[model samples]
Target: MHDASCRAGLARHGIMISLKRRIADRFHTSRLARSSVVVLLVMLLCLATWATDRRSLHLQLLTYAGSLGFIANSVPVVLLFFMVLVVSRRVIFTSLIVSALMGAVYRINAIKLETLQQPIAFSDVYFLRQVNASVIHLLSHYLSARIFLFAVVSLVILGGMYFWERPLLNLKRLSRIVSALLLALVAFGLYRGVSPARKLYDRNVLRIAPWAPAASELHAGLLGTLVYQAIESSTALREPVDNAAITRLARLEVPDAGAPSPVASQKPDIIVIQSESYFDPSTLAGIDDTSRLLPVLARARLAGSVGQMRVPTFGGGTLRTEFETLTSVPLAAFPKIEFPYLQIHDKTMPSLVRVLKTQGYLAYAVHPNDANFWNRERTFQSMGFDAFYSRKDFPADAPEDGWAIADSSFTEKMEQLLDRESRPVFIMGISMEGHGPYLENPVLDKAMRDSIPVPSTWPENAAKEYRNYAYHIHHADHELGRLWDYLERRKRPYILVFYGDHLPGFSKVYTAAGGFDDHQPASTQMVPWVMVSNLGLKMPGQPIYSWMTGGTILCSFAGQGNDYYAMIQKAQRHQAERRMASLDRETLEGIESLSRLYLRGEAMPGNVKESARQSFCAATGVTNP
Candidate 1:
């Protein structure tokens, strides 16, 4: 009886195994029938490209690719893959339709490509406006070859997908293994490439270039060479860089300075305003009537110290500029690396805020946007700011836009802060009203269409949109006027250093306005740095200082009597030496060498660091700390 019962159980187990096999086989057959090799190849190519180029293989890349892919080609590869695999046939078509619709919606609302080039936040509506503008401009300009390029690229992707999907899907078993191997090889290659490239171009080639090359250009050449070589060798992706090693290299020791000096009595309330998209349109002669766009700023130039400020970047990356201004550190040193805000949280920064705090000044950083957006809160706090005001602190009546609080509202808030602070304060206010999505604001739109004159360099084709940007500038001017009026009424001595973060990213507008000449090294990166004083300090007539970073401005204004001032003078002088010595090489190379040493926590070579220290002592009329 026991033997018969065991036999029955064994038979049931065999039946279950057969059923499972049948189900799997059917599933595989169906998949094999539908998949195309060409489609799979294209998808693999795209994935490979993204995997190699992006910093990580995380969800962020997927989301970014999904978002961009949907906009560029009306397809959501991830959603499509899931729908095809899991959903019933009846629902598959419906899913695709819905995905396409949603993609279109997102595409319309996203920020324009040109706008995205800047450091501005993304918005869907803003993107739609750009699409409309691009479409219109493309039609007007009628670049058939450009259009052909777009069409051909699209067709190739789609056609490849249609024909190759089956074979690609069928190869999933083998592909998985191949992908893993390739990814590893690619990562390793990247790591190897970065080090040698940094040493070669960053330390060697760029050091020799006659003109300053953009950081992006340098990075591109390095990445391109690596990719080309890797492909030629058919090697698997390599492992990524060791984060621990990189971090260790980045650490440095702070110099020993005894007790810091007392803050200057005449420090006056220091106010630094980073104006959004502020540029001297007058620089682009024969463009729109800049007089009409910025009448107040233009007129003020005549009465005050005014000239071009050579900034480090164009279009976006405002925080980098802020970093330069606050730290008196040159951006040219670490061309490819981002500002240290993300990387160095614990490092002590010898910034103006810290210098002021030592002297009993209440330091604050004010921005209309989210304080956490770029780790601004932590960065400012680390820099020794006593307080930070973000969107949360904004008044109930503040104006609204896609970004943070409007410039007008920000101005009002700043005025209140100016009055309320008990101690002589140092305030850094960042404006946002002049930010992008220039078409949606009623005030700006009206101004562009009617009052504000578009720059002449604006393509006859893209004039309307360019005019809108000008109108935005006009609005910024009005806000400045209000601030100036309030300052004029005050009895307290204060100094305001106002400048634009960078030129806006509308190449057509810049070219039309005559600010950009393709033949000439386009340097719209040059902004207007002006010092406005209620206490009657005289600034230079020609304020053009050779490509000085922003952080040096504070020391420049404080006069040569403070430790901070002396330090800057020293640094600048040392920089001059390096520059002079590197006359045969590229200035960027020397900057990188200095930067590497600084980041590695090594003492700057020779007397560079000490000279700056001594310069500070001399300027401030105080003994060395």
Candidate 2:
């Protein structure tokens, strides 16, 4: 009886042991499943950072793998990748799409930034809010056949992942715990000085924007670089902030305000026109084309004064030069700041418009674009313009050039504005027609292509671009004639200021045409500026900085401008008549002082006051802005 009972117990114990084994097999991940996940991760890392630059092709993949590991050691980067996958429902399709976008932007920044002095920053994204055909015209020139290859490879990887992998419907609790612990380790690295994201960026990006732009993609990996940029941008320029600097500037003997009369008292029917990407391509040699790119401008130059306008940016960032021209503020003082409009938001920053308002002039700004672009509608008000006239205000029948309103149509709008004005007009016109991505043009572009000739010495791509650019600026030149004709017919005393914002960013073509070096130096991008005024103005014959352009205009006839412009004019050493780039160390100190006071709302020294209105800060407190 005892032996039978023992046998029953042994059988029950064996059955229990078999059940435990089945449970363990169900939970355990197979070697094939583990390998598949590893493969997917490796593929993603490769595709996200596959660089195509010939210079970078050498050992680029190996470099990217190393860089990815280093970047992933940053807590934020790891968190961002995980969150992206989570947001996409862990579907291979959506996740890969995200990876593809990040990769494409990486290449675009690497290629486009070659001609640019800086890498892709948050400010560049802000500019895209108002992209036009000009933007396309410019972007297409930078693209190569490699981009298609990237797309194909990306698609193939995505397809393979989609077919080979099952939905990550569930992860074991232990697997999730491992992920959390890994992330925690990365975060801990900050204290250990291993993955200090901000420190790494500040040390690298300055050298990168100018020298090794390809590194922006390869060094940190795409998403990793972007995450670091976000952190760096938020905290930048804090290093330069000094209360003592503002105090020292306030103490510097204020240069006798050149504008004894001010932006108001001498408001000489000011007409400032910034033609889009306006430069005389004919100035460059080897282009066999005989005619000047802008005949009207050339004729006007003969009669008036001609000089180069040294803008702060290249190819894009019109607002930078525009802001400089308007406010007489040297970008030099804020060298690290990319876009001031984005940076100085919420502040009623002083401008020529604000200063001109103090005088009896009614300032009206006109642009053939949506008023909201570059946040201009609100920003203009902050600049103190009495009114802004945008596309909505233009004549409905105004023709389009490429993607923008024709320059002639823009002048027509200016004429209409001048026609209705009862008060002295401080009218500023910004033309969109010559604005680029000059690859596509209006219906009229085709008709004029034959009329436009190219240089035999120029590359085929350059010849094509020059043709498109020449055709558009030709109309811009014609419209310049129209504006002057309209002004002359009105018989009004006008101070017409026409200047190019910057050279078009035609990198390869410009280099091939011998117009520029591969290094893309700042001096090679000089643009033309012509001032023709009935006010009997004394203009500079040589080059002047764009920031100083407005001050020279305002102070020309009357030698009168407000405290801010007057102060800037005082800083000019050689071209005292203009706001030249003469901000010597002493001048910079003064400007820096004033910049902090105005843009930052910091107070002037107790003993000193820079202007009648002590503050340029609006009632709104600046935070994110």
Best-fitting candidate, scored by lDDT: 2
Q: Tens-digit lDDT track for model 1 on 154-264?
A: 556545554443321344545546654665554454435556433432323322221332232223221232232332222111212233332322231223222223334
Mind giving the per-residue lDDT tens digits that candidate 2 earns over 495-580? Answer: 77888888876655566666533344543567878777655555554466777776676556553455555444444432333444
lDDT of 1: 0.51
Model 2, stretches more than 4 Å misplaced?
Answer: 1-60, 63-77, 87-98, 114-118, 127-165, 169-225, 236-267, 288-291, 442-447, 516-524, 574-586, 603-625
Q: Name every residue pair that clashes in candidate 2.
A: 134-436, 134-437, 137-437, 138-437, 259-560, 259-561, 264-359, 548-579
